[model samples]
Target: MPDPMKVIETHWNSTPVPIDAIIRDIGLPLSYEPMADNISGYIERTDGSYRIVVNSLHPETRQRFTAAHELGHYIYHRDLLGDGVGDNRAYRTEGTNRPNANIRPIHERQANSFAANVLMPRHRLTDVTDESTAALAVRFNVSQQAMAIRLGRAG
Candidate 1:
């Protein structure tokens, strides 16, 4: 299978990652629901189709990240779904920190990494001459913190 970053680049083919279009292209319907503030999003297979619902209460950046994170679950952990996968506070607030034992930390970490990579691709970072995380964040339509994390991990 292609890695998440490659999938985002080759399949999506746009800068700042047109995540909504990609979701739709992949045949996953996305909706914004008024979920608990701490809940980012969830994905599930229903009626032979997949749906992704993000917390509408969150900021646009958070919602975008949540969508990408949930997409990661759909791409990498579909077999692990049980009543669907719900990501809560720890997964969202903690950048790279692994979640506690009760949660599937590995899956959470993978999804987070996937979200980061998809949102701010490494190749795109290299093409940037500004070298400002904030500017890059604006360019990528992601939060500054998320951009920093992506820069730190990028080659």
Candidate 2:
């Protein structure tokens, strides 16, 4: 598979970052559905094709994050994935809440990091000065919390 970061770099021409295009460019099909409240999304390989499903009920911005996160899994954890990964409300898989692993699985952590990078790329954020998180989130079409997390990570 092509490097996820490379894919992002290739397709990331805007804030909110053409997420669906990036996912599709990586060769995965995308869909949205209403899911249980705590369920954000999941990625599964059925038959021969890979697919990413996001909760339609979630906010659109959040869904973009979720999709990017699943893309992260497709990139970093394909071998470890036995079937698929279901992310919970906090964007973590079940049984990944162990504090020792920083309260999330390494895969989950990596995916989350990847999602942040996809949405609010470090190169973009580094060019800004004195912008508020809320403003940046709006510009990036991501949640304030997510933007704050990305900013923190960038620093």
Candidate 3:
């Protein structure tokens, strides 16, 4: 698998981090469809490659976060994926589907961190010390909460 940080760095020419381009570079196919209200998205290895499916009903920011989170599993916890990482609306990985993967909460936190890093690369923020969290979130195309968490982490 490609080093995700390197991938993000190479493709960080724009705001929002252009995750679709990253997905293409990672060779993971993506799709969006309506799903249960409780579900956010999932990433699975089908045949020999990874696939990301996002909830069509979710907000674009959420879909972006979901895709990034799944990429998180692909990067940090590939060996832990029995089937794949399925996340719920609260950003926690969980499922009752038969053959569900036994992923731990630590991985969930890692993935969340990965998503935040991907969406809000810290290097991009170094030049700015006057932006509000909401403004930064808008500039980065992430939720204010996500940016707040990121800024908190950065501090």
Q: Largest TM-score belongs to which candidate?
A: 3
Q: Tell me the alpha-carbon RMSD of every candidate.
A: 4.9, 4.1, 2.4
Measured against the true structure, the TM-scores of the candidates, in listed sequence, are 0.81, 0.86, 0.89
Residue-wise C-alpha lDDT for candidate 2, range 18-66, written one tens digit per residue? 9999998877889999888888988887777578999899998899999
Candidate 2 wrongly placed segments (more than 4 Å) = 1-3, 95-104, 153-155
Judging by lDDT, tell me the better candidate of 2 and 3: 3
Worst 10 residues of 2 by lDDT: 95-104
Winner on TM-score between 2 and 3 is 3
lDDT of 2: 0.80
Superposition TM-score, candidate 3 onto the true structure: 0.89
Question: For model 1, which pairs clash?
Answer: none
True lDDT of residue 79, candidate 2: 75
Which lDDT tens digits does candidate 1 get at residues 71-147?
Answer: 98888877766446667755633332223333377888998888887777777677666578788788788988898
Give the lDDT ranking, best first: 3, 2, 1
Those runs of model 1 whose alpha carbons end farther than 4 Å from true positions after fitting are 1-7, 10-13, 92-103, 127-129, 153-155
Predictions in order: lDDT = 0.74, 0.80, 0.81
Candidates 1 and 3, the one with greater TM-score: 3
- Per model, how many backbone clashes are there? 0, 0, 0
